[model samples]
Target: MVIRTKFMFRAGVTVLALSFSAPALTHPHVFAEARLDVNTDSNGNVASLHHVWRFDDLFSSTVLVEFDKNQDLALDQSELEEVGNVVHASLADFNYFQLVTHDGKDVPMQAPERLIADFVDNQLIILFESAPDSPLPLSGKVEFGVYDPTFYTAIDFVEDSYMTVNNLPAGCSSSVVRPDPDEALAQNQQSLTDAFFNDPTGNDMSKIFATRLELTCSKDS
Candidate 1:
């Protein structure tokens, strides 16, 4: 039996269709560039994370086709809102593709109240904010990254400027750490075996390749 969720039926079709033109072993069907802003509270704790994700042209074209109800060849404000809602709802199953860790422990995030979508230059841009279930202190190490565990969507923090920290304390610092893909694959050989290949979504193998933002704070401050 073939099971397709609303998201798979709508967006996955475009990905699968596009995949045929690429190398057979190519994993990701869709591509996106992401920007993140980490907001801090007065007490030097993480308050929220704001995200801006822009989809590739091919995927954006499919979205336009699906949501441009009036066939106007342009996405109006209402149409954009619908797109945002659909994308936001669809991401719930994947925890919004958010990965946050503090001292090697996963940090739980609360869903954002809104996801704003805009169509620009034939691309789809989505903006949203998510907050940790509780305030995350900045004294220890914190890592943040975004990836699709299913390996269907490749989200890239293409440049160092893609990530920012807001209202940060005096002694806090942040840096972007991009993993060497070849090195990561070599190190995780055993974990990335056939079982992972068969059901990529069942595990977080994508983390090995995800570009991360590392935040650190001095104990004195």
Candidate 2:
């Protein structure tokens, strides 16, 4: 589904239209400070992934003006809900910018629900939860990462402490793995060009820079 809200529709896809003459640029135009929480059941089965994304002030200002329909320079709850609906619908095709793996196999995720949106300090904060296609047991290993595959939006986990596991069985532990691109990719960062970002339809270079979260359960647990 395409972005439906006046604010997110523009911010989601047209971020580069401000400075770039070409809309085809694949590099990131909008940026987000992200936080992810992995929730598990008492028996150590994966429950859901709760995400909080804070849009940078540049794009947040745009959302504020467009979504604040009251002309009061403030966004009310109803206005925020409208933005949430649009974002929830728009991101389905993008896998909500997330990838999951269970025991070395890909884990599909269904569309997220319970979306909440709010504007604060010239920034837009979005809250949502995504569930796996099937029940995932915290067994040998469960890994996942959050990123914009198209490289159209840059999403970064700002705080290490915020990425945590909750309600898991004893002996289960989790950690966030920061990305470290290879020297070739590092030295050529900006020079890599759109081809690197474009990659092939089946593969994306952005995943190389994605921040991974890993959960491991002790065999005894």
Candidate 3:
């Protein structure tokens, strides 16, 4: 949904920007400030992830106007609910754009259990929770990242200190990284044309630009 929201919001700025030209897409159209609250169970296994996504003013202004069907100049409770429903439905296709991995293996996550949308200061802020399809041990290398595989929406960590882990094992700690694509990939995005946008299951280029959180825990002897 973040991806769709990104494109929709960007399209509002200029319709021609959708042409997908390399120079035109040099910078992402939509920017979202994001935070991840990782929670672990008593066994030191990850239980769930709470996410807060705040969209930029340009996008939010458009969304607020569109959703305020009554022309109240404010998104009422029903309007907010509509926003939540739409986001939840759209993001279902992207697995809510949340990715988790442990020791180089993908960690499947279930759909968001709940989504709350609110308009604040001309910005749209969404809060939701996602749990692993199955509990994942915090031991070894655990990582989490959120991004639109198609690169339509650029998700960023709002603050290094705000992306946090709660109840992690005693010896475990977390770190964050935002990686940039190599020169070759950067120079030639033609290979990453709109094909993947139609079917994101095939494109992972966005991961290269995603914000990654890594957790390391002590191993038992």
Candidate 4:
């Protein structure tokens, strides 16, 4: 059965564009499990961000119905490619749902050249690599997080092993930071006003609940 609920794709195929009341704006209509790998260059500078996102079954089923042109009940390679293309194009409007910073300054990321989509266990998986517009030297502190600023989709790093640093330099360590929901809400109450929900591109209030990855490298290293 084709699910014809209120779900609408905007930021990406996995994201839902809901027109719900302000009280319901905080709740996500879609969900995804994400795995991130920070790849470093030979000089130990961050080169690119690799992502593997597995969408929830309900959203995946909706995608299959929309993109499975043959009505064969299974997505073929070409069908999957079509899904990937749509997601890659749509995600650009939302910075691919990536948040990267160096020493508290925002780091710009280039659009991914391509995205690979696959279906497994009734879920849709997307894989892509996003590189910084310029090389980001591994110094001081670097932070990364995946989130839907509009709060239409909830992306979670469900496992400790889901976040990793590859080719990390010596004397550097990485850790995950899961914010306290109550504390975050209390601190950002003003930013979460009704205006925030109405404006999609308004201040990013989602950061308060984002699960972030922090990387610290010793200057001597």
State the C-alpha lDDT per candidate. Answer: 0.78, 0.71, 0.74, 0.80
Tell me the number of clashing residue pairs for each predicted model. Answer: 0, 0, 0, 0
Candidate 4 achieves a global lDDT of 0.80
Residue 158 lDDT (model 3): 70
lDDT preference between candidates 3 and 4, better one: 4
Give the candidate order by descending lDDT: 4, 1, 3, 2
lDDT agreement of model 3 with the native: 0.74
Compute each candidate's TM-score over C-alphas.
0.85, 0.78, 0.81, 0.85
Task: Please provide, for model 2 over 63-122, each residue's C-alpha lDDT reduced to its tens digit, 9 standing for 90 to 100.
Answer: 777667777988898888877776766676668778688776778898876578988787
The lowest-lDDT stretch of 10 consecutive residues in candidate 1 is: 15-24
Can you list the residue pairs that collide in candidate 2?
none
Model 1 ranges with Cα > 4 A deviation? 1-26
Alpha-carbon lDDT of model 2? 0.71
How many clashes show up in model 3? 0
lDDT tens digits, residue span 145-175, model 1: 8877766678888889898888778887889
lDDT of 1: 0.78
Query: Who wins the lDDT comparison?
Result: 4
